[model samples]
Target: MNTSDEVRTFTVAPDDDGVRLDRWFKRHLPQIGFGTVSKWARTGQIRVDGKRAKPDDRLVAGQQLRVPPGGDAPHKKPREKPALSEAEISQAKDMVITETESAIVLNKPPGLATQGGTGTKTHVDGLLDAFAPGEDEPRPRLVHRLDKDTSGVLLIARTPGSAAHFSKRFSGRSAKKVYWALVVGVPEVHEGVIEAPLAKQPGSGGEKMHVDHEGGQPAKTKYRVVEKAGQKAAWLELEPMTGRTHQLRVHCAAMGNPIVGDGKYGGKDAFLTGSISRKMHLHARRLIIGSPEGGKLDVTAELPEHFAASMEQLGFDIGLSNAEPIRDDPPPKSREEKKQAARLHAKQYRKSRKGERRGRRDATTAKPKPKPKPKAKR
Candidate 1:
């Protein structure tokens, strides 16, 4: 809606209230980027109640908003790429490990992205349309992501409803993801937790993360050393208690033993000498997630060729990779159950605070020592 020649005023709907001004525009006028909105606000072209507003200002229901004209143009949809070649289609199909009515599990390979981005033309998401060529079915959507260099079990939702169901499971922490990595050095502790918070590293162009205690999101990881090659390298199974970008990589680095071949975080120390492949030695080993129709989907992906070769070279027991599933059958909580849990947590917090205050009051009101009288006169 960017072709309008005249200014327009609109009232914020209840659904639109409390969202940032930029979000409001994105909802009603998808074509207008936040940059344009900010420019308009800065130049007094955009106003709320005749006053200039910031892009981040929260919108209120019933507020009068003045929008400059650019709303008449037809909305632009993403450009559709040419159809995948037969070879490319076959290649993508080969990656699929299994499929259900609602979901597809893929053993994604290294160096292949899950989704397309800047200069990323070939990815799993782009090739999904090849699965149902010449059909009217909707293209499958990616429910979650794995790093391009990290190969293994990636999930795709076949329908919008299924996507919503799976997204909720992941965001609510009901999905279980187990990763395996070969680290450059054995951890001092056989098994332990990493509870450091994480945030994006500044000026790294959003490609790197660092452990930041302050102003960072809480992140936790549980790791176990499965096998070791003396003090040089180790095979580790990692479970992320809280999902953050590159949480496993960052936590391993923080432990003074970065994942092997992760040059970004580990530098040259990430590599192993000799015949071992220097490709990133991380893999998404297993996933246990709730199914849309019923129970759980438990799947394990075999390691890629390079990873297996590296494990062999490091003298790591390949049998350790076949160990029993670490996490299984994660039951998803309903929205109502989550609400009840929040209420209970608040009640417990209030009760504990009251008890603490009572203990402090009793200590403060304790009787003072009896005064010593006339000792000086005696």
Candidate 2:
């Protein structure tokens, strides 16, 4: 290990452009642990362009990154990935809905984990080796995630640069993801926004979430009822405005119409009595996002078997939702724009108050009382 006593500064490369500050360290300075990087950021030791920066802050090309030196090591070779079997490679390729130079859109099926965990041996990440490029190129990376039970459009970045690009779009909430789900009941309102704050439910080992308005992260979902099956269930087009863990599930339950087959959030009520499949009905139907190569990368995934069967059983028309992309609501006002609006409102209020005062003064000064004398003669 070689330690450095002097500070070091490096310019962000174009390839590293939209990556998080911490991820940059992982790529370029593997010797440093995430905890150390976080501590440095918290204490103001790490600076980007002369300003204190957070570990999650996105880095731009040509930005100067100041690093305080202590942990430095000679370059270590990356660990070789285990060779995947032919079966695994076939499984991975079978899931691809569309592929581009920078991305691979997978129509992920239900019950398959995106990445591995305890007892999770088969996963999309494990099979990513099938898509590996040349020996010098990095393996495809996951830009976003979907629940193991909720299936549909999953984007995989083909390179580190594209990974960084896609990750930034997701974190900035610029990417639009549309979901299709069968909920237990129809919402009284056909279309509206569900704005609720969510927090992890207690005692579920952080495996569950609930609406916790008082102390929770802000979450919003815009839902439209595409069709209904009498009073039994409704097919909904859901667009989550803010991404949160299990956001769509929680919001649907919050509206008193839990998604079909999501027993974790809705319990027994989540399932229907008939031929409806007992699998979670949430499917990520479409994704529209900017590509690294310039134009938008819009892809739609076909519905999984269970969801499709349920739709047919419920007499729903697939054509009801043409899957035409809906326009996103305008972005929130910037700080300067909000300040300008406040100033304009204040000016208008002051002007109205002045007009009221002038009216009062004019009424008081009017030669008005000649009026009552003529009424007595009449």
Candidate 3:
């Protein structure tokens, strides 16, 4: 656990033969997680015969195992946040997945804070640090964040370089961000831009950001009516040109069509607001980050169950978005799927044929002789 001290070495006796050096160190140190041990091994902190060894190296009798001394492991329990609780960790395990070397794409459920504050506990930052604490890097960083109640397309960068690269792209307005939201009213036009300057309201706890005076930062938001219904709700595709806080929510509200379930932005007409779809109707649907290396990096997060259900409830066509184009009306089946379906159909046909034959035989066996025998017995 001591980062300032030299790596501690201990002699493994002949009886301790055949165990993995990394596992042994972990068992002995108890504080070193697999990632830290792997990092040490990568950095030559662990050596065999005065040579660096991989984390999976098998230990020999009398082997001098070197355990590196640097960066203490994260405590068993998060200090500042309880949302990073054991329960949440298990739940988020499947939702958080790495797409590229530097960036991790996560499917955040609504109601979970992307970062912590307010009654917010266990933001995505803590969970990511706990999850992907890269062995090569000391601390991972978040490239961009999501609204506390908005779900999907959250990204975390593992290294500083990657973090900087992604942040620059986002800040420079190069990253293409797409969000799907449900609004209380439909815009007259199918697609349009809202270029309203936004400023923070005084004494607003820094949380409430709104369209302000002549000095506010330039903010623009573009929206498309993905689907529309009279006075019910409309599914929308929102793209923010500037990264002002609450730009989409505020702009939508200003347009007289506030996001559904938005108590802050949605006015008196907001009384008929729908349930918080998948945490909130707002989703970080698609993100495209152009790498300095040239080609663009595109990632998309599908509608979490809640959003999809809300779309279905609102009678909106819960199909593909304008983002990615896929072939076929009802997505085409893969080869494996076709083969499996064919096999199942064949089996069902054979079973049906056998049943039909049995039915015909039973019909033939029901003879007039049975009626005669019954009469004789009577």
Pick the lDDT winner: 2
Residue 14 of model 2 has an lDDT of 74
Question: What is candidate 3's TM-score against the reference?
Answer: 0.61
For candidate 3, the 10 contiguous residues with the lowest summed lDDT are: 324-333
lDDT by residue for model 2 over 31-85, one digit each (tens)? 7789989999999999999999999999999999999988665475565787888
Q: Kindly give the number of clashing pairs for every candidate.
A: 6, 0, 1
RMSD values, in order shown = 14.6, 13.3, 24.5
lDDT of each: 0.84, 0.89, 0.71
List candidate 2 stretches off by more than 4 Å: 1-75, 325-378
Model 1 misses residue 327 by how many Å? 7.4
> What local lDDT does model 3 show for residue 266?
73
- Expressed as tens digits, the lDDT of each residue in 293-336 for candidate 3 is 45887888888787788777777876647654211233455686
How does candidate 3 score on lDDT?
0.71
Model with the higher TM-score, candidate 2 or 3: 2
The sequence of per-residue lDDT tens digits that candidate 1 reaches over residues 1-378 is 336778989998654557789878876666777788989999899999889999999989789999997733365763355578998999888998899988888999999998899999899888888766644465688988998999999999876557767888999988888889999987866666889999999999978999999988999887877888998899998888787999999999999999989998999999988887889989998999998668999999989999988887777787766534444333454586577668879888999899899999999999988887856754
